[model samples]
Target: MTALDTSKVSIKTSLAACFGRNLYEQPGAHEFLQELSQSAQEVNIQQGGYIFKEGDPSDYVFIAISGAIMLERSSPKGARHVFAFLFTGNLLGLSEFTVYSFSAVALTGATVVKINKRLIQNIFERHPKIAKSFHDFTTHVLHYVLDQMYILGQKTAPQRLAHFLLDMDTRLGRSSGQFYLPMNRIDIADYLGMSLETTSRSFSNLKKRKLIEIESSHKIIINDRAAILEFIDE
Candidate 1:
């Protein structure tokens, strides 16, 4: 790992900085991230680079600073499935069960803070509160995963897309109402377990229903939030 320009730490750092105060308030979280700040190194990977491969020994945990990484699993037949999109402040490689159940690959130029696993364990041991915070974090992640499962397993294509858009809007909102998206249809398709064509068609349907408007390929305007939510609920 190389030294990063401290002045230009990415959104991951911003997220950490914004939440760091609250994180410190959490049980043992301050000492953990502080120690982690000392030991962790900032590293960058190019788009499409593998951060860690599936089945690799879990040696380090990653905290995304910028860009996005996909956690994916592949079948024996080589068919690939995406599991999650890890954004800034997301913890990587913290599982105590399997070494790594999926591969983490950069979706774009990515920066992450890499912390040694041993150091993480030591921090957790020294502060049981740190362990509890981690536990709560993982539990929240699990709930999000289950929600993703519900979207994939039951919803129609358009509904799934609506749900995805709403989720992105909610998560990335600037003033809790407006948000801009960096990901395109293909990324959404891969995340939603659908084909790109289907994803595109879903957007078309949403536009036709006046639920959202595609200002451009990379831009969207959600017209009726309530209607979109109702559609998703159905």
Candidate 2:
């Protein structure tokens, strides 16, 4: 496998620049970021590599610096279920216990900064705003997970596909109305709780309806956002 910027350096070198150049809009976050990022170390994962497996001790949480990371779980029968694909600025390893409940794998070769979990408390003590940021982040993650559960239980195959497309559009596509889908059809089928053939058929139906267009099976273009929204089961 090809290397992807693997390094173990102090935050003062690279991440420090990321913090300063981002011009974080949050007031009073400068000191908090400094305090939290001090002991951070950067690690790179090549595509298809495992960052951490299920039952691994969650000593450190990760912040994606580049590429994509996929959170997944395997059933007793060894079927893989993808929960989420994390991108730059996304946090990983948020759990109620000391061990990670799911596995994190590199989808497209990712660079992530590993910060010890101990820093969470320090940040909360030093900067309440950053604590609020953590709260909001946790809430959004929970809501999205719950939304996926609901989709699995209540929505039809086509509806689920439409909802997933809208979600990608809102979070990743934004101004462009197009974005790269790192997960393949099988992964997406697992994520949406459907068969691979069902997932493919749904995509074909959407294209037939002129609601979306697929390019090279990875880059997607949403042609009719309003029409797609109508297909979402709510």
Could you tell me every candidate's TM-score relative to the true structure? Answer: 0.85, 0.84
lDDT of each: 0.76, 0.76
Pairs of residues at least 3 apart in sequence or in different chains that clash in candidate 2? none
User: Relative to the unseen true structure, what is the C-alpha lDDT of residue 16 in candidate 1, on a scale of 0 to 100?
Assistant: 49
Clashes of each: 0, 0
- Give me the runs in candidate 2 sitting further than 4 Å from their true place: 1-28
Model 1: per-residue lDDT, tens digit, 89-145? 777887775578889999778888787888878876887765666677777788998
Name the regions of candidate 1 deviating beyond 4 angstroms: 3-21, 26-30, 175-180
The TM-score obtained by model 1 is: 0.85
Q: Could you give candidate 2's per-residue lDDT for residues 1-234 as a string of tens digits? A: 122222334333333333333335667666655655456667888999988989999888777777878889999999988889877667788676888989999989887878777876676676676566677667777898898888889988988988888887776676367988888899889889899999999999888878889886988998778777777844
Clash number for candidate 2: 0
Instruction: Output the lDDT of residue 169, model 1.
Output: 74
